[model samples]
Target: MSAILESADIDRALKRISHEIIERNHGLESVVLLGIPTRGAFLATRLAQILKSLGNEVPVGTLDITMHRDDLRLRPPRPLLSTLLPPGGIEGKHVVLVDDVLFSGRTIRAALDALGELGRPKTVQLAVLVDRGHRELPIRADYVGKNLPTSSNESVKVSLLEVDGHDSVEITGAR
Candidate 1:
């Protein structure tokens, strides 16, 4: 595997993304962060910590789209994870869906479907650590940490300390 982002690079990208979210939203008063399970949840928690440092207490939650995925029948079904939300729910609040990487956009679509059942948010936006463009769907992220041009055969791997025991990102396959 070839390294694409180092720990420091990941930290910087997240810092920038956090600032952009606050700037675009004008503040974090109505912002709610929901991380797509696995690495996304770790990133969301990191973002929440950064926002907290800025005196804004952001609510971070996890959203598992395993069941909402359209390819459920194509592959073996895995155990479903829990979908946790803040106490107040997302109604009338701006929700940001966080993920480690944006590949085909299918995951984001599944996430949207999952979110719909929870509650209606005033608006829903997407944030990803890496945007290796190869979108099969029309969806796009509102906030992207890094827009890395890539190919269809390549794969992007994100490693987080909370889940992966380290913080880094790598691209594998033909370059």
Candidate 2:
């Protein structure tokens, strides 16, 4: 495996993304973060903390899209995660979906469907740590930490300090 981002690099990238988010939204007002369970949820928490430090408190929540996934029958059954929303919920607020990696875009599509069942947001955005091309759907991230072009055979792995006890992004597999 080859390390594409170290701990410090990940920190810097998150910080930059935070700043961009604030700037793009003209402030964190009415902004909510919904992280896809697993690494995405952790990243959303970290982002909320960063935004808090910047003087704006953004609500962070976890969105489980397991049931909404299109490839459920193609793979083995998986445990379901929690879908927790903020205090005010996503109604009339700008919702940003957070995830560790942006690959085929199927996950994001499922996330959108899941979000629709909850409440109607004024807008929906995507934020990903790594965008490794190969998009099967027409979806894109509004805020990206890194755009690491990679082959389909290669896999991108993201380890967060909260879950993996370390922070780094690695790419592995046949080149």
Minimum summed lDDT over a 10-residue window in model 2 is located at 166-175
Candidate 1 TM-score, C-alpha based: 0.97
Give the CA lDDT, 0 to 100, for residue 58 in model 2: 95
Q: Evaluate model 2: give its lDDT.
A: 0.95
lDDT of 2 by residue, 1-175 (tens): 9899999998898999999999999988899999998999999999999999988889999999998999999999999998999899999999999999999999999999999999999999999999999999999999999999999999999999998999999999876
Q: Per-model C-alpha lDDT, please? A: 0.91, 0.95
lDDT over C-alpha atoms for residue 87 of model 1 = 84
Residue 102 lDDT, candidate 1, scale 0-100: 95
**Model 1 regions more than 4 Å off:** none
The top-ranked prediction according to lDDT is 2
lDDT of 1 by residue, 126-162 (tens): 9999999989999999999899998888888888888
Candidate 2 wrongly placed segments (more than 4 Å): none
Looking at model 1, the pairs that clash are: none
